[model samples]
Target: MAQTPLPDHPMRYALANELHARPFPVLKAPCRAMYLAIKKVENAAERDRSEDLAHLEALLDRYGASRPAPNADQYSGKLGRGFLKWEMHTEFVTYTLFATEPHSEPFSPDLFNLFPRDWLADAPGRIVTSCVVNVETVEPEDREDYMNRNFPGWFVPESLTASAVTEDTAVVVGDFQIDEHGHMRFAVLAHPDITDSRLGRIVQRVLEVETYKSMAMLTLPTARKVSGTVAHLDRELAENAAGMARESNEAAEVLRRLLTMTAEIEALSSATAFRFGAFEAYEAIVMHRISALRERRIGDHQLLSEFMMRRFDPAMRTCRSSKGRLAELSGRAERAANLLRTRVDVANQEQNVEILKAMDRRAALQLRLQETVEGLSVVAISYYAVNLAAGLLAPIGYKLGLDKTHVVALLTVPVVIAVWLGVRRLKHTLTDGEDGHG
Candidate 1:
């Protein structure tokens, strides 16, 4: 019987397949691998990823090997007598070439010649790191003799990190130093009993650890370059904060300086944010890869984790401290700005209050002057009115047998009173008009 078809999302199969897309290469013993990682120095994450794919295709074409799918992120195929595996990451790409043929010399520089010089010169990005890994099968009984015979001249003694990994199935050794050929080297002595898949996983982990370590260390230069500037900013922030506390310092000037400091700190944060973040992620990957090795000590030699703790951890700490200082300074600047702004606002409010008081005093003086002028106007009007009345009443006084001086005296009091009443009424009318308008 035919089963009914079920509904499915478009990306269901693609998403499920993505988990197993980049399976570990099955590597046998007595193999030598050359690993190379390439990345653009600037704007790596935003570069034209298609160019990477095109470059990979070009390499595949040179070998007459089958090309990867158009959208594939990883590909593996045969190259001459060896196998080639290519992977694209967010900010870089990696190529790993495995040669199964046994070599006469361990850590030989000639193994890197498989990659043509012209091809490397034509790469779209600069080399981030390159390493050569030698894999050998050594019986447990012969492991000590093997290490004593080959490890001394090949790797430095003080920085050597040797460990038995995967429950003693293999021993891994590295000095974390670049050789005269400008390539890092690692050796994996696998027990005869280990499976090919397990050996491949071990080799992959070793490469990942080294690659991520180099990537993480890239942030060190950035941190060192910015350290002096950051220190200067820190001192400036402290000075501004001190100025804010002093009453004699101008709040506006201090505020302007604080704003400038804030802008500079913000710019620093923006500039370093991506690098610091990438460093942390790469650092975590390096540690996780090392931890996954499940390393057990080989004699008195340091383990990989111990080597990292001593050599690499300090740089990591520096980057963390720089990021933290930036954050602390940003916070301090913000607080200082807020406090200065409040001080400026209060000062302005006090000034405004003084201005209002001055206006009130001027308004009071003007009212007194207006009152004095109105009184003088009333007196002048009364004097004129009394004279005019006496002059007109002189005829009546003569007809009634009265003297001009008596008429003048009678007109003076009545005329002055009338004029005063009229002036008072006019003032009342004008005051009422002003009140109504208001």
Candidate 2:
């Protein structure tokens, strides 16, 4: 009987398969691994990924191995007598070459030659970190003697970190220092009973810890580079804020400077945000990998985590402190900007109020002058009106036996009052029309 088909999501299989895509490489004891991580110094996250793929393809061509699927982020396959694993990450890529046979001379540089000099030179990005990890099987009885004979010569005593990990499944040792060959060195002495898969995980974890530590510390130089600028800005901000309290300091000038300072702070924040964020993420990975090691101290020497605490932790703290200071300074700048803007606005409002008061005074003076002019105009109009009336009334006064002076006196007061009343009415009407329009 045929079963009914069920609808499935387009990404169902791909998403599920992704979980197992990059399985840890299983390796037997007495093996050597050459690990290399590459990243472009600038805009690494945005670099063309096809170039990375192309570089991988070029290497694969040399071995006559089959190519990885199009747009694959990782690949693992046999190359010559050993194996090659390639993986692409957000901002970097890594290649690991594993050999089953350990070199007689421990920490030998010969295994790294598998990556041809010409091929490495033509890589899409520069090497961020590269390391040689030598793995060996050590009997419980011989472990102490092995360390006595080799550890001192292989690593610096003061900086060396050695610890038993995974309940004594293996012991890992490293100095976290670049050797003369420009490669970090790590040694994993696996217990005779350790399985190949367990050994592989241990080696991978060691490499991851070192790789992330290196990546995380890259942000330290950036933090140091910007420290002087941050200090200068902080001082300027304090002075400007203090000046805000002084009456002699112009609010407008101070506001301008504050705006400039705020812009600079914002620019600095923008520039450093990505690097700081990356640092935090890489730091977390480093710590997590170290924890996964489940390290126990060997004798009185430091554990890997202890070394990180004494050395790496302070660098991480410095970056964190720098980030915090930038944030605090940015906030201070914003607050100062807001206060200065308010002060400037209040000053402008006061100036506007004074201008309005001056306008009101000028309007009052003009009104008074206009009233006096109107009174003089009324007198002038009434003078002409009284003279004409007197001329006409004289004849009539003659019939009643009155003199020209009497006619003039009789008309003057009436004409003057009539002209004044008319002028007042016209002025009131114009004022009323203006008020209605308004």
TM for every model, in the order presented, reads: 0.89, 0.95
**Residue 75 displacement (Å), model 1:** 1.9
Per-residue lDDT tens digits of candidate 1, residues 59-96?
Answer: 78887889999978999999877799999998899999
Which regions of candidate 1 fall more than 4 Å away from where they truly are? 1-14, 380-438
What TM value does model 2 have? 0.95
| RMSD to true structure for each model, in Å | 3.2, 2.2
For candidate 1, give the lDDT. Answer: 0.90
State the lDDT at 257 in candidate 1.
Answer: 87
